[model samples]
Target: MKIAVIVQDGFEAFGLGVLTEVWNEPYHPEDDNPVFDFVVCTPRPGRVKGPAYDLFVDHGLEATEDADMVAVTAKRDIASPSPEVAEALRTASARGAQIFSSCSGAFILGEAGLLDGRECTTHWRYAERLQAAFPLAKVNPDVLYVDDGNILTGAGSAGGIDASLYLMRRLYGAKTAATAARRIVVPPRRDGGQQQFVRTPLGQTEADTLAPLLQWASERLDEQLSVERLAAEAHMSPRTFARRFRDETGTTPLQWLTSQRLALAEELLENSTLPVEQIATRVGFANAAAFRHHFAATRGSSPQAYRKTFSCCEEETAEQAV
Candidate 1:
């Protein structure tokens, strides 16, 4: 597919780099992947510089005219998007090309009037400004990204990675996205909202060691795990452990534990015939009432509701197999 990446002065280099690496990189020879042609476009054709040191691009805005998708990179300045650039985006969107943005790039889409009445996200730091500017748009600050079919927006820097990977999953499949994630050594999918990371400090020294503990906890969600017990397992005092855990991860221990338990409950709801009370016990909730409360709070629906909504398709597939 032909993809056009919009660029301009003072654009975030890493955001642009992530898109380029994912869509423009040569695929492994064994897979015979289709070529994804990426073109860098700017308002003016030649020698446009970015916010990063000594990085300049040499493509004009006209490059987007024929693209199948337009990916807008965030700019250091969000106050003014050139009329020409905005018009180009409008025209592309009108013609049915998929539009996407990372971080402040959502501002450009807003400028083009593409974000009106749509659910979207941007870097949390800028979400207020974006919402204030485009009063018609629904801004969700807690998500890693918002995928509204043809138009998508990511929350922040690393969220750009998540947004792009999700795009790959939608276009290709789970297997292709998994392959891409394996190459980068990041998880194929994250379990919770980016809010889990907000307001928490990361521990520098203990960061790498937490991955194993997280995996172990995920597998044993049925057991009661107090902060004291978890701290003991990590070989640290509770206060020190909490601080380090928050530092290493961007969330509190209880918040992380709740997220994992909910995830496990979701899986059981979709894949098994276990009663709500049994599933609640399996995931360490004291009773079905507690499970229902937490699950509804996190997932916006009760266990039976979630199962009723998600189980139909899976059952259909199973019946087809039979």
Candidate 2:
């Protein structure tokens, strides 16, 4: 695959680093992992100064024309990408190439009219500005990244890594993506979204007070848990407990518990050979039917299908052991 990463003057070094980390670096050469033909492109093929240092690129705007994926790294003066660069991005998009942007690069996509009416995201600090500047684009402030088919937008910093790996997972299989993630010391998959990283108004004291209860609940995901039981454990009435839980966790107790269970189920499905029904029971679901319904609704796929698609364990090995 050919990957053209468009770098402009005053570009963010971390953004370029992530692009190179996920695509340019070969993680498992012994296993014959796919290697991308990665090249840095600029509006003018010459020395461009990034925030920390300078980089020289021989490829110009034309480098993106034949690329399978064109990524716009975050940069300063984001609202004003050169016309040649914008046109190259638009031409790539029109030709069905996968287009990606990290952080403030969403502004470049907006300038190119690629974000119009598309569900996209950027850093939380710039979400409001991005939405205001491009009213036609739906900027989701609470997601790490938004994959609107061919056009993908990532949030700040580490979100670019997540978005890049997600693209790898989509192109290759989950095992291949997991191998890359392990090599880089990042989680193969992360649940929830940017909401997990948002700083809440809750005081540290209040959050600390609920730490034990939260830990206890997390450790017992295989057992049925209820608001009443949790409230009793915390020595508070159900109403007060529920309110305190919301204040500390930024979500309802039931919702928090459900998300934890779903996360555990996903881990088990990916790494273990447990049957779907057995996995459902172990995750505290009443039965396989309820598990399937919730998994389908939340993850957009049946548990069985998800396991089949992402499972890293071998079926023949499991069958022989059984």
Candidate 3:
């Protein structure tokens, strides 16, 4: 595949680094994977300064002329997208190339009118600005990325990795993307709407008071875990523990606990042959009715339905083992 990554002055170094690392890294020859021909392109085809360093590009915007996919790296300056860069992007899109952007690169795509009337996402900090600037574009700040067929936009920073892995999944397959993610030490798939890092005043060490308590609670989900018990586990007053927990996790203790329980319930549903009532009991839910309600609320599906869909693969594997 011919992949062209567009770079420019003030472009984010980390976002571009993620792209280059994924596309440029040569796989082990014994693996028999197809080689991806990757090139860095600039508007002027010369020296371009990124956020952290300078790089010289051998190809100009013309490099995208024959490319199958064109990825725009994030820019530090989202307020203004250069006219030349906008035109190049529009031209690339017009040529039927799959267009993608990371972080604030959505602004460039918006300026080029490619993102008009399309669902997209940018950094949460810039979601309001992007929506105001491009009213026609549907800006979803909650998502890590949005793939609207030909044009894909990633939220921010690590979201670039998510978007790139999604592309890899589309071009290759889930196993291939998973392998690449293992090589790079990143999760293969983070659902698009997963929340980004929350802004908080507490530093890591100061805020991590409830880590052990959380781990303990996760292990004992089948047991009742109330505020008093959680506080005791953390060796703090209930009020203090609740306050500190919210500060560090950006969510209330109960909310976090509910999410963890839901996750555990999901795994149990997918991997076990136990009935809904049994799974509910194992995951600490009071009954099958309560588990069904919370599972639907958090996962957008009934417990039985989720199990039915996800368990198929496991069922196949079990049969193959037999």
Model 1 clashes, total count: 4
Task: Give candidate 3 regions above 4 Å deviation.
Answer: 29-35, 66-68, 91-97, 166-174, 201-204, 221-229, 236-242, 254-322
Candidates 1 and 3 compared: the better one by lDDT is 3
Which pairs clash in the backbone of model 3?
A: none
Candidate 1 achieves a global lDDT of: 0.81
Q: Write the per-residue lDDT of candidate 2 for residues 231-262, one digit (tens) a residue.
A: 99999999999988877776788878878888
Give a tens-digit lDDT track for model 3, residues 1-322: 8999988888898988998877787968645455688989898878888656888888888888888889998888788667887887788788788898988999989999988889999999899999999999999997788888699899887898998887886677555676688878997776565666554545667666667778889899999999999898888999988888877776787777777787777667666777789988998889989989988876678987776556635575456558
The RMSD of every model to the true structure, in order and in angstroms, is 5.0, 3.0, 4.4
The 10 consecutive residues of candidate 2 with the worst lDDT sum are 191-200
Write one digit per residue (lDDT tens) for candidate 1, span 149-236: 5898888877888888878866765556656777677876664264624453455455677777788888888888999988888888
Query: Evaluated with TM-score, which candidate comes out highest?
Result: 2
User: Model 3: what TM-score?
Assistant: 0.74
lDDT of 1 at 62: 81
Clashes counted in candidate 3 amount to 0
Best by lDDT: 2
Query: Which 10-residue window of candidate 1 scores lowest in summed lDDT?
Result: 196-205
